[model samples]
Target: DDILPDGFTKVKPRKTRRNKTDTTGFPPLPPPKSQSETSHSTASDSNKQPVPNLSVTSTPSTSQVPEDTTAQPPRKVRVTPIVLRDASRWRGVNHKFISLGIKFERAVAVDAGIRIIPKSEDDYRRIIRLFREEEVPHHTFPLPSERNIHAVIRGVHATLSEIEIKEELQQRGYSPLHIIRLKRGGGVPMPLVVVILPKVEKSQQLFNEHELLGLAIRVEVQKNSRLIGQCHRCQKYGHAQSYCTAPPKCLKCASDHMIHLCPQTEQEERKCANCGGGHPANSRTCRFAPKKNLEVIAQRRNVSYADAARDATRAAPSVGSSANTQNVDLATALRSLQQIIGPLISATQALQAIFPANG
Candidate 1:
């Protein structure tokens, strides 16, 4: 007990109770709710609004969505090229074309002339007609690559006309653009017929034997006779004289003049300009002659000129090695002949001894 001042009060400490441990290993659980309490809690839950699921999403149907038209790429158009000869004479040709409302894809200067590529067939025809109307010298023929594939059919009777052959081919489900009667020198017709067909898989089927008018005829791919162009103006291979801009070169002596104007006579030694060989430049015997034809082989085989040249170089034997190879082959042939002759002579002598001659 203590003496208290006026308006002063004493306070007592509060007591805490200690929790008792369960004899079982598990802790004690809460008591179950009463039936009325549970019913009341269920009623409260039913009254509460349901929460929406933020993770779930729904997509629109394909039929309801608009297509993306801008996503697609545009198709490209194929253009045809046309060549105009003597480009120098066709000055201001582009302006003239513009005035005439002619449309072209592009124009490129080539060795022959101006090569104009038109966007459409209508423009191609219009350009051709314009050239014809102006009396301009232009080549309208398609390039070798642009032309349809050609195949030769042999064993066909010369008496059969082109129309008859074409009709027969049509019956066999082949659409031939043209049929030509192959002729020899001096216009003498041969049994061979050249058929021009479209560049399709079916066209290859023609390279086989077929029955025509009760006779079996064989067909083969028409190979190009000359693979390179020879320029008459310069007496060089690769281009024609009309398109050649090179200076005149004589074929006889390879001089820097026209063949007719060559001062060199036949009595003088012949010289080749291309290979400096003893023969003429245009001679088939020239070492470089095969190189000129490589272009044609490359074009027909659909390979690059460099690849064809490499193949040709590897195939062609060197002059010195060729001579040695010929000598070796000749000696081998002689030895084989001697071996054969010795056996033959022995057989003949034996036969003679067995049967004596009446004389």
Candidate 2:
């Protein structure tokens, strides 16, 4: 090394580089090929190593699956509320109120061929009272002249069946009822048989739309206990009271054929007054005895049976017609008549009330 110029430094001899093949030979021996390959190879070189052992298996390709156009998303299910029709058909019919123990109550009848019902017992009572008080004239306002279906839908509390509904209508003196089907909430149409009762406009007007629906619901839930036995004492249908055995005495006389059908018992039993004993003071036979028949001595006195009988009564000895005598006679007659036909009259009245001619 020697210092030459001010900017020059000491010079040293450079080292020579090695050749590429001598520095890093091939990646390592590839090893020999297979025996089968060796037989076909042109030459087997030791420098070249055999191929590494590795599994090479081909996987079958899969085609892309086409999207399913028919597969649909799950549909939303919705339950529609049921709307009832023919509810008003059972109006004016009689229904048994189990809670109240009333065998019969005026039911909401039909308007335009539909039955309607009240919501609560109060409403029912109010409606019934209105019908009774108003009668035919209850609704003074002119009705909607057009035929409109008066439907009452059963609500959540419905319990009545079609048969029971029909029976109730019949009991209230309605002939028959029809069950028709109506769709609820615009979904499916269902059978909705209508039980038509007496149509009273007055009563119908009292109910609002909701009340009418409720009433129909109530009717649907009503139950009917079938009529079976008969009351022997009353000689009527229904249940027979334990006391409904044979009469103790003859209803006509106090005889053992009722012990001659006792007058006091007959009166108590609401029997005909004329048949009982005519008078509490006299027996039935004596009270019904014909008046004294007086014969006319002269042929010229020929008279009709009515006139002759009248004449005989007039001629007969009588203390005088007094208020007390007349009262006694009338009382006796009434008691006798009551004993004979009282039950019949009662039955007739009941029939009339249940099925009024106009009703």
lDDT of each: 0.74, 0.40
Top candidate on lDDT is: 1
**Please, what are the lDDT tens digits per residue for candidate 2 over residues 1-359?**
77878968788878886644645645655677898888656455655788887988656556555566897888753221111123442333324234334332233343312222444344444544544453411211112232233434444223445666555545544444354434453234444444433345532432242323225333342233232333223222232334222233332333444322334422343332224533321221233332332233112357665665565445522222344346667898999999989999999999999898972
**44, model 1: CA deviation in Å?**
40
Give the top-scoring candidate (TM-score). Answer: 1
* Residue 136 displacement (Å), model 2: 36
Query: Ten consecutive residues with minimal summed lDDT in candidate 2?
Result: 136-145
TM-score of candidate 2 on Cα atoms, chains taken together: 0.14
lDDT computed for candidate 1: 0.74
